[model samples]
Target: MKQFPTHIVAVDGIVENEKNEILLVKHRDKEIWTIPGGQVEIGENLTDALIREIKEESGIDVTVNKLVCISSNTGTYEGYNGYGIVPTKVMLGFTCSFIGGELSVSDETSDSRWVSKERVLDYITNPNLIERFKAYLKFDGNIQYIEYITKPSYDLKLKIKI
Candidate 1:
């Protein structure tokens, strides 16, 4: 039998507190800030994975409200050996409401904070993350879909609200 390529499925949340602030976390290995999230483990659903990731990375409890966007990207990563092309990553972005828990960082996160909506873009500079955030802002009872390639160059393949 021939082997086939596999894609990674991940989940990210745009958690909002009563004060309208957004939860952002900086991973230990990453310099840029991004919303808390991680890959879904086997036997875990998207919402469950999201909740667990949020709690693990930021020590914050949140309720997944709705999915805002679904994005796929063919991006590369730097490994111990050298730069390698990573499998296509399919991420589901959700809007979540903060339930409870004191804000704290974990081993995976170097820092975590609640940033005002106006200043969120200033902290998150990744183009892909910025696009996901924009999709969250534009969410209107509809889910947005985005597909892009980041290897040779950043090229947007498809973007539409469904």
Candidate 2:
């Protein structure tokens, strides 16, 4: 049997404010706080998808600033339910400016808030989130990426020299 080729395109917006705080969505799936984003539709550009997902999920309108990160990873989510079965996603991350929107919850989100870099540490133990946010916070907003080739095992295809 031939292996199937399935690729899902996803976009995540790192919306930052003048105070350097980042907007994060408290997912209804788990207790993790992640950026607002979703799958990029067929024939749709990456930026357009990020814009749409942020609005839909977090009620936040965004103006994409830059491709801060390009992460390529293949991993199993173990018990992750939202995007199921054979899961392989290509996530395009962009830095964005918050234009205007009210804080609201969607089916996918439990809560949404603008958090300071300091607060991210308080939310540790949420899987690999600590490391992920550390990269974004430590840097001077200098776009980067963290690719996980095999999760569940915490394996990565690209290694960062720390």
For model 2 the local lDDT of residue 3 reads 89
- Model 2 stretches astray by more than 4 angstroms: 1-4, 76-84, 124-132, 138-145, 160-162
Candidate 2 total steric clashes? 0
Candidate 2 C-alpha lDDT tens digits along 1-162: 898887777888778877887888888876677878888888898888888899988898889987656565677454444646656667766779988988788999889888886775665454334445555555565655666755556665663532
Residue 100 in model 1: lDDT: 99
Assess every candidate by TM-score: 0.91, 0.78
Candidate 1: which stretches are off by over 4 Å?
75-85
lDDT of 2 at 5: 82
By TM-score, the best candidate is 1
lDDT of 1 by residue, 103-153 (tens): 898889989999998899999977788899999888888899999887677
Q: Local distance difference test, per candidate?
A: 0.91, 0.73
lDDT score at residue 143, model 1, on the 0-100 scale: 94
Worst 10 residues of 1 by lDDT: 76-85
